[model samples]
Target: MEGIVGYGAYIPRNRIKVEEIAKVWGADAPSYKRGLMLEEKSVPSPDQDTITMSVEAAKNALKRCLINPKDIGAVYIGSESHPYAVKPSGTVLAEALGATPEVHTADFEFACKAGTEGMYVALNLVKTGDIKYGLAVGADTSQGAPGDALEYSAAAGAAAFIFGRENIIANALESYSYMTDTPDFWRREYQYYPQHGGRFTGDPAYFKHVMGAAKGIMDKAGMKPSDFNYVTFHQPNGKFPFRVGKMLGFEKKQIEAGWLVNKLGNTYSGSSPLGLTAILDVSKPGDMILIVSYGSGAGSDAFIFEVTKRIEKVRDLAPKTRDLLDNNRRYLEYGEYAKFRQKIKKAS
Candidate 1:
């Protein structure tokens, strides 16, 4: 069976508090902090972008696995923040891991769900005997328009999953997806920041696709929400996930471990995938995990996994998501954030 053998995530140390952003816009900080349940959001340094972050995350995942880099036959990177508009981040990632010259590589984008899309494909390829192992990554150094609501929540992070048939950690049981021509959020070519449908993004877009996909996967696997030990959904904010979980008959405890949006903001494509990584870090043998990811185009990918005893052997090989979130954080003022994000463009 196809299963996750190794996984890792990278969250940048620099951060911007909601108050710092709200102060610049002359908006109420208490409202955003309480409403979105966000205090501070991660930010990438001037030296870090999607490619560099992806490489770090990939290296961490590789460290947890017992295999040669040359054995990974496929490399897929899913992100909305690729450094180049026309280049493949996958090649750069594969080359960095020394997995090239004999691997299939590609870049993926589906708003926030792109990472799970890559994982879905890699798992299938391994199940089909196409490769010994595959690396799938979801990451973003997201952009938010100045003075817009997104400015408070769009954040930077990455998660990489390595799947193989050997020394399985979490055994994949089933998968499903739901999609439509929803236009709740989008970014046009040459646009620096994305546009959203405001309140329209809630009921009709994010919630619908997420719940639909989650239900579809449970039905396909002949399991109920109560059968899972943990559940995680695409977290646009800290609130959406819990609301969705309750609607789908999952309890607060089921989703709490993976509900990291409050601390990290929405990492776009890395959101739910990173949540799964968090669950894996502490999941016990035989525990079941259900994950559903939503992207803005928009669509959702639902997956069911049952943890294996092998998980205990490697869960500590790399850093846990919580440690990174709690470690040394360099706070940034609005001006410093603008400088780091390149929001203040200098004339050539």
Candidate 2:
């Protein structure tokens, strides 16, 4: 059967507390905690970018699978913040991963959901026998306006999944999607930060698309929210995903199982995939997992998966999101954060 054979994740080694950001801007606590629900956010170093993070994630995934790079037939990289505008990040990743010249590689972008979108595409390719193994990666180092609310929450991470027909750990059962031409949030070509419609984004864009897709998949599979052992959503912040969970009748236990945003902030394209890696780390053999990913322009992709017995053997090879957060970190002040994010350059 065609399914996910392995998974991996990468979180940077730096963190900035939301309270620190609030102090820097002289903003009240309510805005940072209540509005964003983020206490700390991960910050990548100057040496790391989307491509580097993706490579690390992909490496971990390959290690777990023990598959030769030559066996990977295609590589797909999903990111809105790719290091280079003209070159294909996937191709660069393929080279870094030591995948042979025969592989097909490309990059994808669809706001934040691009990585999930790449997962869907990779699954289809593997199912059709177009590839024996495929890699799908989601990574980003998102930017927000200096001193803006988004600055405190925007972060970086990467997750990679290797899909194949052998040793399947989670089989894809059903999938559903919802799309709309809503401009809930967006950054123009020349813009550094995104423009959002605020309340409109919450009500019609995120809620509508995520709910529509989740419900659609559940309905198609003849299952209810309680049937799944875990549910992970694309976390733009800590609040939005939890709100959607409540609306969809998912319990706190289910939502908390993937509480990535609380500790790591929003990794943009990497958010949902990183959550999936966490789920796989603690999930049992027979557990059912439901995942939803959302992007601006607004769209959502929902997927249903069932864990296999093989998971117990491979689980240890994958990095737990908690460990990734707790063990690896370098604290940064507001000034350092600005320099890492390139808001300021030193005098020549």
Candidate 3:
């Protein structure tokens, strides 16, 4: 009976179009549109950080679940871009959530996949009856080098899920994880942005880990690509997932069902979960959804979910990703984007 009680997502109100970035740097402007398959990327305001984003996502999720904050026995935040270097962001989130003193809370970091890793931990706790309900959040404000290709695509967003035994909306059927010492992408403690091995990240890192975990889940679950009604992957860029799907015998139709990257860019920790939220919006009862997440250093986690009758009833509580994208937005200039990203500093 342990399953997802509710889910929510938070996308910022501002965006930066790839075309604008392209136009600003000249005709070729890094080929952001062609290379990353991103049209616009979400940009959080100065006041909004990982903590604020997670709180918003968690609040929406709690509203959908209709559970009192006191009932939440545990809260976990997964992020690499925490607002404070020393304080546990989860503690700040728990206070914002108004959870009781009995709550157990902590933060988690595993590169970009940390959020999904939090979900996995929350699921296990709920399944064991150690907690009646738990909240797992994934959020990030990722950065890239000033002129690096990742600059345009790195974005911000957050997703939250409440796990419990009652009122299950989607049941986790099976999960598989693949880990390796692949250093396709990484940033050191003092580094401002991540370093990538370029083509190597695609061939042996992202593709290899994602495919291994995905195939492992499919093999264990006895399901095929056709069995899933929707499939979502951690989108570093628009082309990687599409190309990986092709290699695995899945067509564009299956991959495009999410189309998250084209609109939202790579949200780092929020990427796959945001894609899953997109799937849930259009998914029907009994539909199957498969999710895969990848992080540099590198590793992949794959999950299989089956929607239930309760999903229809709970659908109205959260605004879908499409609604979020269409309804709210502010535009920023390249210089403003640079400032927000801390690529440039203002005079004191």
Best by TM-score: 1
lDDT of 2 by residue, 1-348 (tens): 788998999999899988878888899867678778888899999999999999999998987888889999989999899888798999889999989599989898989998998898888899899899989999999887877777888899999999999999999888778999999888888677788787787888988999999999999999999899999998988988888999999988997877799889989899988899998888999899999999889899888889999999887876766799889578999988888999885798
Candidate order (lDDT): 1, 2, 3
Best by lDDT: 1
My TM-score estimates for the predictions, one after another, are: 0.99, 0.97, 0.96
Predicted candidate 3 versus true structure: per-residue lDDT over 1-348, tens digit per residue: 788898999999889888677676564644667766778888888888999999999988987889989989989998889877788999988999899588999898878888888888888899889999999998999887766777778889999989999998899898788999988877788767778898898878898988998999999999999998888888988899898887777777777767677778788888898888778877888999889998888898888899998989988887887788778688998888877777776687
Each model's lDDT: 0.92, 0.89, 0.85
Where's the lowest-lDDT run of ten residues in candidate 1? 58-67
lDDT of 1: 0.92
Q: Which ten residues in a row have the lowest lDDT in candidate 3?
A: 23-32
Count: clashes, candidate 2: 0
- Model 3 misplaced stretches (Cα beyond 4 Å): 24-30
Residue 56 in candidate 3, Cα distance off native in Å: 0.5
> Which sections of candidate 2 miss by over 4 Å?
345-348
